[model samples]
Target: MSSHVPPSHRRWPAKTLAALTIGAFGWIAPAAAHFQELIPTPPLVNQNTGATVTLDMTFTHPMDHGPVMDMGAPKRFGVLVDGQTTSLMDRLESISVEGKAAYQASVPLKGPGDHIFFLEPAPYWEPAEGVMIVHYTKVVVDAFAADEGWDAMVGFPVEIQPLTRPYGLYTGNLFSGVVTRDGKPVPFATVEVEYRSNGLIEAPDEIFITQTLKADANGTFHYAMPQAGWWSFAALLEGPEPMANPQGDMVPVEQGALIWVNTQDMPQPSTN
Candidate 1:
């Protein structure tokens, strides 16, 4: 999370401008949308499962299975249960994901209710996009069949308030949520969606990689997931103020409100 620029990444302003010039006309392949992933192993915790769950945090293109990016130490990592927020920063263990810096944590389920895990990652500099990226990401783990409290908000700078129950969904079920920033609706906010790649499916084209949609006047959006897996919904917005880049130059910031949910295939009836 250090703002200091590494000598290896430091480059002259002229070269940076040249690279942008070339990229503007399509010399470089379009970069896939970045998604901050906060995924829980097993996704759901029930009476039949273990007492603890493992969470993986990483910055990457979930749909592309990555060339993962290095993630700095997070600014905040914690969980919310029954309106109480507990910091889990000390429990984070540094890990290598795809040979890139990432993090993992083991969280014990204290009791029944929805455990809302949230992360505020260090700002990431994306030279290609010429912006500092910060994604406030979260995921919900339902424990002991206590289905209440799934709609609680973490009070991030920007976030999605779910209109649909985020867990225990069947494939093709429609998901809905409202985009909010500073506790107010962000009308017509653009949301990017991606399915976590398991390496079994391939995108036929770039269009198939990331799906984009716009929230309505009420800052609400709805999407039906076509497959069974972990899916990410990211509501993108511009930060109110610019941030200093590696070069100490002020640049725009891309603030994202992200949430991850999982769906399963419905079991079919047995033949008599």
Candidate 2:
């Protein structure tokens, strides 16, 4: 039951080197082989409801005659929406443990915001089950454009924040709005969110999030919980400088840094 077993680093002891050389007609023994590297990557996609989202998680290895192990059943896959995790689908396209196919998945833009997804191989390894190691992939999707009139800023989104798990709310969730130049909303602007840890930046422990959202009419937007982590939200104006309100002010679409927000602490995922 010990999980800290040491790795086999050496081939033989010091004394064995002499005898092995003289055992045969100078028949030099072949080198020891290393364990095969797994399918380095996991498949990911911005699947939508009613849309065909292809499932292509092919790795560096080949398909017909590659170094892949069958998972018999697709039990090692899972899915997550925005921030609330969901179960992986079983009826996918012509795909296996290491295959790829054009799948159709309907992206549900039921509302305006950013939807983030994380895809990775199931961690548990078993010969009776499949591969020796596991992996995962990640992706993001944005559907919005404000200022022109198609923004959700004027009113609440169709999808309300859930009060509990499977439909609950979290603090890491992000919100954005159309930035105006001269009392006018900037249409079709993009917003990005980054994380800062202990006042320092660029640290992996406090890295930036790849996900971004678009602004709707009137220059407003929002991105739901993508993950359970500390983050700073920022807004930008894609269009030209807004004529100052006679006072003289100028700012770019890149709002420079993220806006800090307070989030409620929640329990970590249960291992059971």
Candidate 3:
């Protein structure tokens, strides 16, 4: 059999072929949930650097994989312990992650107790969404088994008050939290959940990238993590007031109350 093929159809570079195929289908992956990731070096510090914990802060979509967005200097950074909060903003150091502006800070754990480190990032101007984005994020570190202050709130415009213990959990435990804005429950608020990807898992569909759930009348929701890794729950709501955009026009604020908790796989029974 003799057939003549077009010159362009004879051969193509791998990269060029990929680009052509994608362009032909007009294929685009789903946008990931915009999460303010305040991940500590160690989710739990048993014995640490002079009782200090280092945290890496970035803004990105954790589930759909990242095209990490640049994070500006945070407005506030602090830790709450024994019902009291102390400012740590002066400790923030400029850094880069995935080629985007990010921050790193070390928080000193002063005593035998659980400390909740929280950050109020400067409002990020998301041009695509045409609104300012801000995420008030918090994570808990337990020291010396004091086991207190895990339920304390950081008093952001929006915050998550954990109903379940925020730490020391095996995988498959039910994690629960109450969504609050201004110290009041937000009835039926929308919450988005994402797992910190290990780069080996793929989403079955666009909708599967960021799992969504609605809170009950009391603004509480819960989920059982299927795998062992850091999981984030974000409760999103509208800001109280609109902020002026670059064009000097008013635009709504997209605010989020995000919390991170880590889980470990259950140990198998030992055989004698």
- Evaluated with TM-score, which candidate comes out highest? 1
Candidate 1, residues 1-272, lDDT tens digits: the string is: 12212111222353567668786776544567888999998688877788699999989999988869999999999999999999999999999988999999999998898999999999999886678999999999999888989999999999999999999999999999999989888887888899998556899988889898889988899999999999999988888888999899998788899999899999999998
lDDT of each: 0.88, 0.31, 0.81
Give the poorly placed runs of model 2, Cα more than 4 Å off: 1-52, 59-72, 94-112, 120-131, 143-272
Question: lDDT tens digits, residues 1-272, model 3?
Answer: 01111111222343355567787877544345788988886677676435678988888877755878888789999888898898999889999888999999987677788889899998888765566888999998887778877998889988999999888999999999999888888888888899988456797878887788888989999999887888999987877778987688897687788999989998899998
Q: Clashing residue pairs, candidate 1?
A: none
Native-to-model Cα distance after best TM-score fit, residue 229 in candidate 3, in Å = 1.2
Question: Which 10 consecutive positions of candidate 2 have the poorest summed lDDT?
Answer: 1-10
TM-scores of the candidates in the order shown: 0.90, 0.27, 0.87
Order by TM-score, highest first: 1, 3, 2
The candidate that wins on lDDT is 1
> What lDDT is reached at residue 248 by model 3?
84
Error of 1 at 186 (Å): 0.4
As for TM-score, the candidate ahead, 1 or 3, is 1
Lowest summed-lDDT stretch of 10 residues in model 3?
1-10
